[model samples]
Target: MLIGCHGIPVLPPYIISAIVYGSLFALMSVSLTLTYITTKVPNFAQGALVTAGLYTGFALLSINKINPYESLPLSFLVGGVVALGIYLVVLRPLSRRGAPVISLMIATLAVDIIFVGVFGIYSDYLYQVKKVYDAKLFFALTGADFSLFGVNGVVYTAPIALALITASLYLVLTRTRFGLAMRATVENPNLAKVVGVNTEVIYVTSWFVAGGLAAIAGVFYSFWQGGEPDIGSVLLISMFAGSILGGLKSIYGAVIGGLVVGSSEIVVTTLGAQYIGPWVTPYEPGIPLLVMVITLLVIPGGITSVNWRRLLSRGNGS
Candidate 1:
């Protein structure tokens, strides 16, 4: 009787999709947040890192005779390693030289362009391999599909897994000594170095952690979509949307922002616009980005860092 059907609600496919979408966005937001805090650069290389990781992992998934379930961990490892490589070879050296911020952004953008070109080449190779051989070397990856309390619940396990991951990450960032040092570095690097915190090591560690997390995000996304190439096209919009919506500073806000982008953009725009007519029908994917731009214009700082609460507090003090 606990599973009572008093007023049974139907869960739409778009809703389920948004949940998965948002979860991935949340992960990306975390990566952006990590680089932003530690390196003091927006890390425009982030998108490229994601694409590179996706293609590289997809290559491995295509070749391996082993279970895809097993390959997932290794794919994620490849992603992290790739992210760290970009940091070491590209961003770190430039950052140390006190390079212009715009120059760094452009450099990262160049990295992104290179990644896209390489990814296209790799994708073509995969297509040729899949076509010329005309053979599908099957790899078993875990998935689940079942009713959730009599509702047609079809959620990929990866999204839920990622949510758990964010929780664990939150704990690590908030609780660990390394976490404190990381925060210190963000607040003031020179001071942290003077205090003997080894800011350079922390910088490298930030890349590792963030890159590893981005890889994890990639895996979750791949798992959610059931394959590769989804990372670049689909994730790019939602990831940036979530990070911006989250106010770019608060980890908690990022999670909430991901949910908002996922739910509103996918479910609302897809379904709600259906009733309103075909006028705004095709703007579904763009909604998140539009919202993000509008949001930043309205509150330049972000949702979390907005000083409304502080203003209220001052009023209360008065």
Candidate 2:
């Protein structure tokens, strides 16, 4: 941490934190992108699943007294299971009817409402209630950095982890049958089905996969940010920015969007405080939203949509 001239500031670590935070955003965006891909709907309840993910991580890490790192995987399981239930009870029936856009949006919004209400009840329950888990465990993951592909003075771990996760996802989407089925459903469900694919199964699996990815992101979020219901309420904004940046169509676009959203946030916080000095508190959150709007208005196509096959061919050629 260093200060520039005229009380200007430099905190490289926070920039890295932005990347980590952005990675968390990316994880949620992955789920969001997938939902958009297969169902051709935004899955507005994405934030709800994000909250569920946070709770799952908090449950395993705080309530179960599990080590936070080891407890991480449990969060993904919980996310997947919850998403599966949501699709079965809520989304599947509607999709069967070929629900219209507004209908699907309303349905997912209803799910979001349910999630918010339930989480509120839990928050109240935990409030004057006994702490079943060690609150100390919740505070354990303070500040830290990791070093691979890091500058000598600055270490970057979150971004590195996120990159690894993104790579793994890319491989899955490009190199697997399930991936093809998933994309097939995205391109055209009827056509995919006509070609001997089970579109229904693809959708259900997509929801599960999306929810699970949200959980993985949520776990890191709890690790990165201390877990609480309020955080979940606020996370929707970040997720939305990431999705919009990714063109809301391509998977890799979401990755770039998450990074941009994250970077925009950190940059604003850093520079805003130094220049404006007073409006900092209220202005920070809006930076990404502001950036998102400008980007949408400017680059309509977003981050250049690459045919997955083209990207793969280039990689092989290289």
lDDT scores for all predictions? Answer: 0.67, 0.72
Show where candidate 2 strays beyond 4 Å: 1-11, 132-157, 305-318
Estimate candidate 2's RMSD in Å: 6.2
In the range 127-175, model 2's lDDT, one tens digit per residue, is: 4374634332244244321323333211244466568778987897789
Clash totals for all candidate models:
0, 1
What is the alpha-carbon lDDT for the whole of candidate 2? 0.72
- What are the clashing pairs of model 1? none
TM-score of each: 0.81, 0.82
Which candidate leads the pack in lDDT? 2
- C-alpha RMSD for every candidate: 4.5, 6.2
Give the C-alpha miss distance for residue 155 in model 1, angstroms.
2.2
